[model samples]
Target chain A: MSNEVVLKFHKVQKKFGDFTALKDVSFEVKKGEFFALLGPNGAGKTTLINCLCGLTDRTSGEIAVLGVDPEKDPVHTKLSLGIVEQEVNFDPFFTPMEILRLRRGLFGLPADDAYLEWILEKLSLTDKKDVRARQLSGGMKRRLMIAKALAHDPPILILDEPTAGVDVDLRNSLYDFLRELRTQKQKTIVLTTHYLEEAELLADRVAIQNLGETIICDTTKNLLGKKNRTLVIETCEDEEVRVEIDNNSLDLESIVANYPHVKNLRIHEPKLEEVFLEFTKNPKS
Target chain B: MNFKRYSTLAWKECYRFLKVWTQTLISPVIIAVMYFAVFGGALGSRITEINGIPYALFIVPGLVLLQSTTNAFMNPSSSLIIMKYSGTLSDLLLPPLSALEKTLGYMTGGIVRGLLVSTLIFAVAAVFTGKIVPHDWGVFLLMLFLANGIFTLLGTILGIWAKTFDHISGFSTFVITPMGFLGAIFYSLEMLPPLAQKLSLFNPFFYLADGLRYGFLGIAEVDVKYSLIASGVIFLLLFAANFWAFRTGWRLKL
Candidate 1:
């Protein structure tokens, strides 16, 4: 268990005055594992990430990333981690390429021109690298954000709302780049996204949080499997309905007899979106 | 943790102000000269010398202090606000740099801008009226740095608190400008009644201006020692506040 742990939260909590943004929540990201901190808005997915990044202080408990305390050893911890914030803040005065150059200098990391070119090329930001950040479109800005986070080449990458307000092509391109990072760079990714399908596609484990508590933490299959055996039926007068039922409670014969128009009966794997909704509905862990 | 990173960031910040000199650096210097030429030159001649220095010379130090204060405060404050507004501030914050590094980076920009404007005003003042103050390079530099440091902190705090463009300007107009005018910048605190002079002692900017004037003219309405101690104390307090805000990820990152 210790060998695989990349990040561990021991009952971490955060409170803004009276409102607890994150309850006594704890979770782990295994080494090199693609993980997701999934939740709805204000559900505390970003709150947990903020605590890990030292952007927000935790009211209770401890957080260790890469064997360093996030609060006490933020510099060392930050060296091993990269975070893409939910909100965007770029230097309007500097061009995209200049920003990356400045960031590289700030980190005291030597410029690997080859890697820089490769990232810019892959993210489709090469052309606009010369243009100031303010001139770029929203999606372009998001793409440049990812590129900046990637520039340091940290072992852990945390993307918060990475694909927000992005066009489909750019989203696909970014995903392809991330998938490459996950596979080739040995980079552990903590993806906080509203798109469940993206999580299902990339995250090795998905943790759904609600009201500051983690409601579910398991592999994508195991979590999605619990809500399988959905029953979609067409009743009398061409009436149609859908239901997700437990396999134990489902009687195929009874279902078919009750609704004869449900002729195209078949079993399909559960979608991650359905399970996410159910996970969010319950607040208490 | 590494001090070199702060140096690098600070260098970058300095370069930024210099690169956009026309706006951040030059405009303020030109404005400072214009104020001296129009007000100090035209009106100061009619005015008699005070405290063994010409009226024009007497007013130059405080006016320069005024420019440095505004520039120093505005440089860092506007830097943070621009990053917040234009969505690019993340460039510096997300890295391994310590909070002190980031804080120093922004503060250094303000310091440089303030010093540059202050120097330009000094040159223009020398041409407009000989040796604006007697001479004390060491104390002059000290008071200028202290004033810049204090107002830079003020600007940074205002920037953090401000959510919109007008918010920053509003603070500058309603608070900073009023404080500058009333801090005995153009008038001697000694001219005020006993109660008014006592009240002006409470103004930190007054100490800043008085201490700076003492360096140039060797005369001040208040004790130079008291002005030095007050300005020094304000600088340290503001530095602590700025560093704390930086460490807490205050509104800078959020």
Candidate 2:
């Protein structure tokens, strides 16, 4: 990934009447990077996305997509990035092909049937392109949303829970598609999802937000490396015990020596899931 | 503004109504024909004449205006409300199309539907009254656009403001429908008492009906010049209001 920041949010805050949705959000995603935004329910993930996409106004702060502020230049920002909103927003009356064509025109892009067709094929929506969107299944609709986002072939892709209700198989296929987009197409991706495992598998870097504030943000490798590792000890009596220990602070040799009757012993690297739980569960820590 | 994008949005608006021709086109014509049959045929016999034009012929322009007005108001309002409720409005909101383009695109749908209904009603009215052409084609076309433009933009504004289907229907029923009826669709300003006539002058729909009536019959109770100017001003105001609504993302953006 290039060092240049493709997306940036500096002290973003949003308020709805007396209720604040985004308290203080700030982050940056580099070009060609797959950045995941993970948060619990009501953590202002969608609110932040709304502010970034110009769907809503932020009460205070700045957001820039490739140096163009969305508030000042919404058209440029909209043209630069394609967003798959958290909800299915396609018009059911329109066919996939019609919707895509309309979207292409809306973005002020030249007509390219071949490109749109390729997008359909990439999302496995080729056969369903001519059918009305309402008739499509839930997974198919989700994929169609992605296709619509890619209609303009934007440099950046921001998917807000793209696989919320999708089945495992389709979700896996979407992951592959997203990976291809990042790798082959060199598209910068900013994803917000409830599925931490999805983030773990796909995101190069992740940010965890809770109560409208970004609690932690770092590379997956760095975050996992910083977290305490787990040590599992299995005794000859078929009893097993797990202990959390920092690799640097705890002496592994001394811990292993304490288990003399151990039949099996293994050291486990902390998973992103555990790290996410820890940070969100105790953000102050 | 990109012409291609604006034209595409306009085409999409047209496509939306055309996709449901039975409700948008045919139903309005059927209702217009029914009104002509009941009001023009039955009522015309007793009324004989209005403003020196045959009663059936006098009511023809009013009938056309009435359908055009209702359809023009309903088209954009329902289109907007449905898109809002379904969350499909983001497709338009996220696009790079300018606010002016969006306003014109949506207004095009309502104007087209209104004109189509007017044409259909005029054709049907011609069969009964035997007048296919208007007295003044320029005035006819101008009134058609001004009246249609005013209501269509009103619908666009209401569509953005309305949160539910009830809000749209309620406004149509309580405000638009009552205003249209009191605007002299069935009778002339001279037919009413002096107080009612004064009240009729206050109704914007009265100017619309009178202006269109002058176009069809070359006769009107009120001066057609004032009606033309008033309708033009109203149309421009509504157009600006809609443009401002889209530009500011009023009620559309969170």
Candidate 3:
């Protein structure tokens, strides 16, 4: 939303013994941007997140959160960042409220009961606030993780595979909440999800990583614009029959106009999943 | 150091054990009572005095130290190992906490559990033996504090290094328990043969038990000064090890 950069990476590399998790990775996230990072499993998306939050030290390269290098000043850099990890990992004994309160305290933030209550309500966790985390359903635990991350009102939020196991209704609700946070609160967000549709719906800018290297970074509009379209034609003879063809072919329009059996015809735009496969299948593309 | 973050972590550690008082606090007290009843009561009449201290009183400090060290070691070790395996350790790592702050926070839990168990055993021993007063109050407190520090550090290290629950329990069962028992807790070094007495000097638990015995009953098989020095050196070394583990994020970081 703004020209100010919230995060920047310069040729960052991470190695685990002989295996390299991230190699020469460089990217920048602007302030108030809804950025989506797409990667296959073991593509080093979590590794990048870990580097930004100082959970692990990068083997080589430079990273800046806000204006501070995370490796040099991790605590200070972390003050402005919130993270919702891929796994649902809460202290089993603690309730949702207690977990949020504890997280806020860890950030040295003063108690804001009203804000906490509001977060619980927004996440649909008010009814389950008193229940222990271990007793909560998977969806509820995911919501609780989001609540905990947002408790301290961080300027930037990074969510990793947030909706991996979530149902459609809950995932839709999370999308609405995240959209609200981006548009209304103007919080910078970076999300990594296996669901390409989620990224398609919310992301302003998208980056796809493969084999520990970022293969593509561009505006969502530009990336989607490059996708191929599909033409679907429905016909009724003795029974209904469907014919599919590439929308870009010259014969597509002629076939619809000339075919007497054609009852309905539609052109479908390329989905994010198709584009994702295209980009990941051939990283150079 | 951010006091708020440190205190929050420390409080969490304390709260974890307190929340499971039956397992963390009560079980250790029960075990200490059994030790006192079996070893101190049954074996006391056979041996009247150990180095001028009553046999019951002599074994009291050793039992206290033994329980203190074991619980102290187990508390942080299990907490960390569970967090690691369960993937909850990221909860602490993601926060804006320095490595030192994290270490101190976890150490507080180990220290509290260790001291709590030791105090309970001391109270129970006082009732049984009718000896409530320590020979030297200052030395007793110092020795107790140092012993807790040593084991808590060890626990913190193992907690960071361990990848599985069995690894943590294995260390406790195979290393800590054997060292505590063989460290002259029940029998004096004089009771061992010459070679065994020399080997006993190498056991750190012996120095811990002897140091505590000196504090409680004013008698020690090893010199109190030497024991204190050994405990202090071990404490510093363990502290360094824990600090290194935290700072480097060994096994903790992805």
Interface RMSD of each: 2.2, 0.9, 1.1
In model 3, state the lDDT of residue A40: 94
Ranking by DockQ: 2, 3, 1
**lDDT of candidate 3 at residue A60, scale 0 to 100:** 95
**How big is the positional error of residue A175 in model 1, measured in Å on the Cα after superposition?**
1.7
Off by over 4 Å in 3: A234-262
User: Tens digits of per-residue lDDT for model 2 on A81-146?
Assistant: 899998987887799999999999988888999999999998889999999999999889999999
Query: Weakest 10 consecutive residues, lDDT, candidate 2 chain B?
Result: B43-52
User: Among these predicted structures, which one has the highest TM-score?
Assistant: 2
Which whole-number lDDT from 0 to 100 does residue B149 have in model 2?
87
Residue-wise C-alpha lDDT for candidate 3, range A19-124, written one tens digit per residue: 9999878889999999999989988999999888877888999899898898778777888899999888988878999899899988888889899999999999
Compose the digit string of candidate 2's lDDT tens values, residues B171-249: 9999998999999989988888999999999999999998888888898878899999999989999989999999999
Lowest lDDT 10-mer window, candidate 2 chain A?
A246-255
DockQ of each: 0.47, 0.83, 0.70
| Per-residue accuracy of model 1 over A195-263 as CA lDDT, tens digit each | 999999888899888888878789987887777666767555666667666756667786577565554
Q: How close is candidate 3 to the true structure, as a TM-score?
A: 0.93
Q: Give the best candidate by lDDT.
A: 2
